[model samples]
Target: MPEVELLLRSRRVVTPEGVRAASVAVAGGRIAALLPHSAQAPPGAAVADFGDDALLPGLVDTHVHVNDPGRTEWEGFHTATRAAAAGGVTTLVDMPLNSLPPTTTVPNLHVKQAVAGPKAHVDVGFWGGALPTNRADLRPLHEAGVFGFKAFLSPSGVEEFPPLGPRELEAAAREIAGFGGLLIVHAEDPGRLDAAPAAEGPRYAGFLASRPRTAENEAIDALIALARRLEVRIHILHLSSADALPAIAAAKADGVPVTAETCPHFLTLTAEEVPDGATEFKCCPPIREAANQDALWAGLAAGTVDCVVSDHSPCTTDLKVPDFGRAWGGISSLQLGLPVLWTEARRRGHTLHDVARWTATAPAALASLGCKGAIAPGRDADFAVLAPDETFTVDAAALHHRNPVTAYAGRTLHGVVRSSWLRGRKIADRGTPLAGPVGRLLERA
Candidate 1:
């Protein structure tokens, strides 16, 4: 093994075993060893000593949208990954849609990867899209090294990426199962949505009513049944309705290969806090009431929810018009998810170890990135140096994302990321990304 090239000592280092005072030794861009916090650095090894700040495994957010190639105005890889680094995210898997080619085929996937290769500031991977007509592309794309396939049960907002009907979704799932590939879904029953009252005008209540919990519950129940029968691994994306927790838990107990993820918006923001016409808060599976948020937290603590990710979707400011009905539905918080999550997690008495699992370990496992996530030997030396007790008020314009628009605009958050290192190289320092893009394009390990 190569000699240690760098050493990081922290009073509180979050590791797979738990949080404790430790010194992490790094060599050849990977973790070499873990020792006591007071361990001395070997000859020729550079050292950084963090007295009381917590050193966490760099977060891995599996749900992010970087609309490059076709919609660079919305967000490109360069700015998006920069924001991710600033927020302590070391690795992210880009969503299939939103980008120009949509990643529905091998060629499209290659195009997006080519565009991202020169721009990403963090290690990035791709997810292929699953449409009714793209059935043949499933295995080929998976073989081409996409992490998984993403399918939507209802309208996908954009005309290019249409949702799959029940039969089409089943076909996609069955096909994915044959090849041992994962299928993640945007679960909202279109029938329930069509039956609900129209969400027109500026009222948040009107928007909330349009995406009822029944939609999520019905969709989840059907997915559970599908997983049980077809024996395919299905991941529920950005789950908002806590009413479906019991069914999800039951499915897990029954040994159905089903997992679910909720976004930071659902965990922190609430409909009551969203004023009328604040379209920035508008997203599909809309943020629910305070009680619903509470239930979601409880579900998270009880292990019913698998992980928390940022569905970091952003659009041009014009696309985010003031009216809730007219504005685009997405939230861009790649630059704020760490603090946003920590602020809420701490209040609930959750430890940094728990945060690391939800944001890093679970996400890495979900995507099957075996060599990343935890601060253990043989893993990439990805670390997020956080002042867990520090506080900061968000200023949208100060963020590194392409557009200065986010739902976390003015909120105060805890746990500021003082620095972030990817593969033993500092990518972000004092909430700013260092010059040059050091990220690499990643495929399935």
Candidate 2:
């Protein structure tokens, strides 16, 4: 038998089969076996018993914006991954846009890796950009091993990363398809946004009106048609409008190669409750009403929405202007995604298995990270010991992210993450100092 380096026994170990009493054995940084709960540890092997706390596969958040390099002040690899560990996320794929020289070229990706390689505290991968000007760079970026490419149909908030026009979008899709790479898009129609009334105040209603659901629905329709015609793999990022769910369902049913993800904010908070001047809740394709949120939940249940991610975009507090129109739009929820989603999901009759599927398994599958998102043997021994019945009140100042701005402040949440393991090593534990910057910079296989 292989020498087990560590044994984690739990009364509630979440596996692909289901949650059950088991002892997970780790050897050489990967899971070695799933033995009975009372299984004895191998000689000299370290053991940690979690009792009834759910031992879940560490989460895989594929929609994070780490924004290192030039935007490190907003969020960097060190703080972002540390925050991810605190939230029970073991792997996160960084989005390309917000960083300086966004990963559109091989050299830019190298620069990003150099900075992140030394600072990350959890496994990190990257997505390359599909900007209007970088069509030729797509194949090179893919060959260099970015997980996929990110494009914006509407204007990206950054001036350098411009949106792809219709022609540019199709050209890029074709180029990516030729290489069999995935294309992830921020889909909000530019024309629809331009036609909407200008938002100029602190009122949440005005901001909601400025970015209507039609913007998302129309953009998704265009992307679906293009995906069907080109036969390229496509993923919709941070889907906020439930009206587009039906079209997404139909696209998938028709064999269009498409998938979609929604964020924790959309599932947990409603526009009706956002107070005026609460710019922290200001994200593009803004959070909608309760009915829309309910539909989003239904979409997840029906599998029209493949996963939930934090979309953990953050900017300096100074950038968060009191006026909703002027503020930079994003929600900083990297450290709160699991608890926030679990608190809401459990209330809706969902189980921990359901939460694991949305936050880990599906997102891992979306990014094609096979070794992640599960507790089975031959997979990375990354796990989160979560006390599902434990509760906590959010306090922004206490979070590990560089910036303490978050929309979840003051809210009570369930499922406190007691500790998180990365590759069989403890990287984070509640009330303990972070272990070290030992995370690997991953490449697509």
Worst 10 residues of 2 by lDDT: 430-439
lDDT of each: 0.94, 0.93
Q: TM-score of the candidate numbered 1?
A: 0.99
* Clashing pairs counted in every model: 0, 0
For model 2, residues 1-445, the per-residue Cα lDDT tens digits are: 5789899999999998899999999999999999999999999999999999999999999999998999989999989999998889999999998999799999999999999998989999999999888888999999999999999998898998999999999999999999999999999999999999988889999999999999999999999999999999999999999999999999999999999999999999999999999999999989999999999999999999999999999999999989998999999999899999999999999989989999999999998899999999999999988999999999999999998899999999998999999999998898242768989999998
Tens-digit per-residue lDDT, 179-209, candidate 1:
9999999999999999999888889999999
Candidate 1 residue pairs in backbone clash:
none
The reply for model 2, stretches above 4 Å from the true place, is 431-433
Summing lDDT over every window of 10 consecutive residues in candidate 1, give the lowest-scoring window.
Answer: 318-327
Q: Give per-residue lDDT, candidate 2, residue 163.
A: 94
Cα-based lDDT at residue 346, candidate 1: 96
What's the TM-score of every candidate structure?
0.99, 0.99
